[model samples]
Target: MPLALVDCDSFYASCERLFRPDLRKKPIVVLSNNDGCVIARSKEAKAMGIKMGVPWFQIKKAYLANGGHVFSSNFALYGDMSARVMNILECMFLQAYEVYSIDEAFLDLDTLDKNFNLYKFGCHVKRCY
Candidate 1:
């Protein structure tokens, strides 16, 4: 089966960037419920030793010291964004595609006659996203 897996880098951060221009180049974190832990981190945040599920209290000092912005999970916004992404994909491809998560999807390319260009296809998916 020909398949394509599209994974967004720093998905939460990218989602935040979509709405807030100021966050585009900054260190950002998406926290879990009650702002208890870090569920997602931008590349910058990852480099600073802020691990996923690290208690918010333990990381608060370092996060502030490092100028990281913490945000509560905005599922509403993320969900809307995800729907748009899926709609784009549905319009672009003829074969069946399944959204695995907000940041991941699988596409079937079995019908394409030529050997599928996985990398190029991934690039297209990335751009669509």
Candidate 2:
């Protein structure tokens, strides 16, 4: 079966940045509850060598020194953003899609047009965001 997976990478940081556009293109990292660990990181943050699950204290000084933005985990916002993506998928796929996670989904491409250009279609789906 032809299947397609849609995943929103850096979902938590992406959600945070949505609210703070000033931090767009900047390094961003989301911390777990109690500000304990690095849970989500933006592309910029990852480029700075911040690894997932690293204790906050371990990288705080250097990260801030390089102008990284830190956000406390905000699950509500992330869930809402995820819902938006899922809604778009539902509209596009009808009932031929299954939600994989808050940040991921799967679509049954075999149910789509037989002449579908998978690469072009995938590009369109990605640009839906």
lDDT of 1 by residue, 11-110 (tens): 8778987877887668899998899888999998988888988988998987888788888999888888788878877776654788899878887877
What is each predicted model's overall lDDT from 0 to 1?
A: 0.82, 0.92
C-alpha positional error of residue 24 in candidate 2 after TM-score superposition, expressed in Å: 2.0
Candidate 2 per-residue lDDT, tens place, 70-95, comes to 99998888889999989988987899
At residue 95, candidate 2 shows an lDDT of 97
Where does model 2 exceed 4 Å of error? 125-129
List residue ranges in candidate 1 displaced over 4 A. 113-129
The TM-scores of all predictions, comma-separated, are: 0.83, 0.90
lDDT for model 2: 0.92
lDDT of 1 at 105: 85
